[model samples]
Target: MKLEFHCWKCAKGTPGRRVTAPFNDSSVYRFECAQGHVYEIVLAQLRFEVLAETGMQALVDGYYRDAVASFAAALERVYQLYCEIVALSRDIDETVFKSTWKLVASQSERQLGMFIGLYMLENGDVPPQLPKKFVEFRNKVIHQGLFPAENDAVDFGQAVVNLVQPLLNSMMPRYTQEIEAFMIRHFENAEGAGRSDRNKHRVFFDFILQFDTEADDWDPAPADLSAELVARRSREIAD
Candidate 1:
């Protein structure tokens, strides 16, 4: 089905049309602008495009793609949590929840990204190509609106979903174990998933380090952060 809408970035009239890409089978979408920049919107969510034309990809993403967003957000929170526990935990600061909660919420976004990325790797639809600088820009959004906007996120999200369909079916038994196997599949010349400790965390760490320089705060906690007191309190308030 052809989706009619304006280009999210250019505000020019464009439609979700398809053309063959060099590496993949499915026809990836070509979102064009009158000026020049074209967005290859792969996983075509008609609903999102409609809203995006109306200038609401951010809102739509928050609703539909909350998990991916929350993953990054959660890590940012854990960063603060770690810093706080390490330094400020001694002082009972009431304003501690500001950035911490936002970061915790980002955990879901990370999970969603992992889920989709792994899924794409399993299938042959798209390669496992994540843009590092793009994420770095999002981190900057904390200070200024200088980062690349939600369109890139939408494009990446779509590509991930598209690529995972095939792999999702074949790579069930060795899910995490197989991330390495397929890492080379997408990143042909690049390093595949390294089994060793320092190696495995590159992609994981790369995702987080884009915004903040700290490494993954993944500790063998007794419970998950989402399952801990913070989540419980949030739930209580919601209830």
Candidate 2:
């Protein structure tokens, strides 16, 4: 995955350096323009959102296997985020939480188990499980190296969207404070890492599946890959 941004120093009536950076685990991205101006941009979108966007792009480009892998990864990352938010609610120390996460970090099955347990405990309701068909599809694509067709890839992406959207809506209202706290910590870490008097810091938040709690009537588009692609491309043209 990659992100493109215009350089801050060269943004007048002239064209600015359009810097592109590969998306890694870190939210802070540093870029130096052709004119030697440096920038530190902290991406505010969570990891899951970025992964989902990458999956969508892959699907659009006909990389079906890569699409499935990225969508599956997005689901796992959201599970981790859910666990982290739950821990934050309980006033858990970040260090201890990181240590606990290490036990399951390398194993996605263990992470899923953690998320299920936490959701049940917090919500007092059974969390939604990935349908068996989707599970088999994911296992085939990820473990057995199956190259899915475009329709199958779209179905898998839709399944992920169906599962994640409700979870996001629920979490937004129930854990608003915790979510805000997490974002604050995220920006603080990014700023601290890239701290410099000479460098300008900027925060960017552009998630494909974002929810606006403040909006009175904001219905998300249906979980259709084709519709999503059209809408995304439309937005790109507008920008």
Candidate 3:
């Protein structure tokens, strides 16, 4: 299916048409803007949003098992997105990032909770307890083959949404500018110097991050700025 994606170059929506190649079983797609910039769609990140939406719908339809599984998949994608942003921001070596991600990705849901706790501490954000609760509920459903209550699925789905919304709002514009600058620098370096294989590579929009003004208010409390509260929140997550 053709999907409408935002072109970072044009800052507008462009259609990404699907292309099927016989040589590869997986489907490929491309988006080209009027400015002659082309992009490849990253399917995995797109799938995360799809699954998240499906989970919410399934919860409403009373498909609790499917809802739990879909939410779990979406949560995993969230971690991947977080890692990618961190790596890019820190300018971590690609090889080292991959090696570290391998170990982090192999962790169980409980371990992910702890990792998130540390992550939030480092970022000076209070870690919400809902993510850990969702992970625990998902683990029960997956490992124990137990069904979650409809309310449990609903709560998990909402929690995941809550966790992702603000993150996307703060990161998307920064990353957009970063990628654009990187591309411009890359092309400038290659100009008149003879084109290399690197010049042929296109920048793809792996994920779409947007903010909703109508979504739940995420106002920070005055106490949130206090060092004592930050310490207390960190300790609360740890315990």
Best by the lDDT measure: 2
Error of 2 at 220 (Å): 4.2
Query: Alpha-carbon error at 7 in model 3, in Å?
Result: 20
Model 1 over residues 1-239: C-alpha lDDT tens digits? Answer: 12332444553334333222221222233444555555543322212122222222232433324333433343333323333322232343535634544454456454444444533543446533336653564455433544443455444333333332222323323332333332333343223322222221112211111111122432211222222324434654773
Error of 3 at 84 (Å): 1.8
The pairs that clash in candidate 2 are none
The TM-scores of all predictions, comma-separated, are 0.21, 0.84, 0.52
Off by over 4 Å in 1: 1-68, 71-129, 142-150, 159-170, 173-239
lDDT, residue 105, candidate 2: 97
Number of clashes recorded per candidate? 26, 0, 0
Quick one: how many clashes does candidate 1 have?
26
Q: Which residue runs does candidate 3 get wrong by more than 4 Å?
A: 1-47, 109-118, 129-133, 173-239
Q: How does each model score on lDDT?
A: 0.34, 0.81, 0.53
lDDT of 3 by residue, 147-213 (tens): 8886676666666666666565555555655434433543454342432322333323322222222
Error (Å) of candidate 1 at residue 11 is: 43
Q: Of the pair 1 and 3, which is ahead by TM-score?
A: 3
After superposition on all CA atoms, what RMSD does each candidate show versus the true structure?
Answer: 21.9, 3.1, 13.0
